[model samples]
Target chain A: MTIKDIVYIALFVALTAALGLMPPIAFAGGALPPITAQSLGVMLAGSVLGAKRGGYALLLFVALVAMGFPLLSGGRGGFGVLLGTSGGFILAWPICAAVIGHLVHKNANANIWVTGGMIAFGGILVMYTLGIPWMAVVGKLGLDKSLAIMVAYIPGDLVKVVLATVIARGLRRAYPNI
Target chain B: MLDLYTPGTSMLHRMSPGPKMAALAIAATALFLQESLLVTALAVVAILALYRVANIPMKTALAQIRPLMWIFVIFFAVQWYFSGLTLAAYVVLRLAALILLASLVTLTTRASDMIDSMTRALRLFKPIGVNPDKVSLAISLALRFIPVLGRIATEVREAQKTRGLERSIIAVAMPLAIRAIKMADDVSDAIESRGYRS
Candidate 1:
């Protein structure tokens, strides 16, 4: 790979890591409630890097965590986190990244609102699909309780979606190449 | 802020995005399916080898992962105290392996290639009346903003620090929300001006 590509990749990785530093806001759920602003990085990764690179960015973060970095929300990482209640969402990241990337890439130059909404929807669903089941299994709670816990995050996630969509649109405008 | 691709001429880098993605899928599946520590160890080794192949400096890679040391400790402690060491080890190794595999894929691949591959993959949904273009747009926006938001967050933090805001919720959340809202509006205008549809 060229030096230029390396620089861009580093930039993306750093960006993803930086997003993790955002303070996590926990709702009134006992052990685990969804963290806010976490998905912003995921959304940005898809929008800016397109599909492949965006996925790569997320993959990089996952890799770092695997390598034992506390880059995830709540300073959680390592294999244990994956096997725990959050494993499902952790596993879903790349899938979500790929899906979001594909959706955004299809309309390379669509307006921000439409693109943002599509991404927000896809990202949230992917997280929920993966997170709910894992929560059920790990927490040993019934599907109903797991679903209820997952539900608490929807409002917050929606906010993230809107924020992600807007920021993505803004970036496109400011840096057309992105 | 998810821009962490490192360019290299490793075999992993030369692999196609489609296969790389498939490999990740396979690896993750295997990770979840098998609960053996031996399997997890092998996976971790394989991941480390990929990092070597990618020529990612060990120091750099470690530095990237260093922050997670506490996480490992906490996880190990919690699992060992509450569950058992075996389970804790299993969890750590499995997650580490998966993360490594993913990072290797990202290090070797390009963002553009990923986007192209995704756009192609989503064609199957067309029969269901899903517009692949719309889907792709959303993906792109999400990917692009990860880093942007990260940068904005940093700026916000620094600004808060300057004001001696002690990193409280109000100090961080208020500005972050305001800035995010303003950013959203700017993005909407940008999209409209660029001929993007609502």
Candidate 2:
């Protein structure tokens, strides 16, 4: 409600959008292109904003897309894309945000690695679970192929998870309130 | 570096985070289910109206979207080239709508309030072996760090530029990485000192 909160929220929204500009990993012959640095923003939202606010930040981003802003990576947007092949992943943003927030809040004083892993795994599950089904239905791929394509994303996502964890933990050290 | 949120006092802002989230979920689902251009167009119009109702400044909204112009162009081109113009148009317009709507939400709500709402939602997961507290903490940490990382990145870039090493990835990246590592260590210590548990 205060000016500071408004300022921070605005900053995070821009940060999330800007980070989306990071080049996505293009896998040859895969069902989907795994975006690099995508989850970094997601993790950042949760870790910094805490459980509820973190998810809200992401929700804010998703709402923008629903309202027709081309803020997603690669300039994709609109309701149609949401129904397209990657709709599932798009839909998973809020859930992932909540999961990341919850994990970090619960282990507020835990080791960075454990907290990081929890957030990463939670994110991975949300994206993949939502993404695979859409891949199957929209892309017309079977479960096996959908799973295979989804699997290609794990390595790249893991790297993001680690980075998010490190950066978040580091920021906490630098600023106690965060 | 860009501030995309426009301050507003729309009904959306007054709406609780929980209901707003639910609405988004429902709308997103509807979007995915309806592939008709008519439906998509309607959705776009509805989002714009929400912006108006929310009292977001038009100039501010447009400015927020300006940076993304290039991405939209690239996507339009790629989709056009590979999937034809019609599909490209559809995809671009749809994505644009979503982004704008999200901007509206962020512009109105406070980050801390959003965090609290999420923590409450996840508390239901406690019975499923999930700890809402820990999860929320991690999310808070990540969200809080985004700006810090951005600041660190900018500082590193500036430092590199001063030495005429701006063009070198190593010059910018190395220090950023080092600082990030140091940051992680500090976070762990702070959490422990605060008497919080993992």
Give each model's whole-structure lDDT: 0.64, 0.65
Candidate 1 at residue A22, lDDT? 67
Which sections of candidate 1 miss by over 4 Å?
A: A1-19, A23-85, A89-178, B60-65, B82-84, B143-186
lDDT of 1 by residue, B20-60 (tens): 77777777777778778888898788778768878887675
* Window of ten residues with lowest summed lDDT in model 1 chain B: B63-72
Give candidate 1's error at residue A89 in angstroms.
5.0
For the second chain, the TM-scores of the candidates in order are: 0.72, 0.74
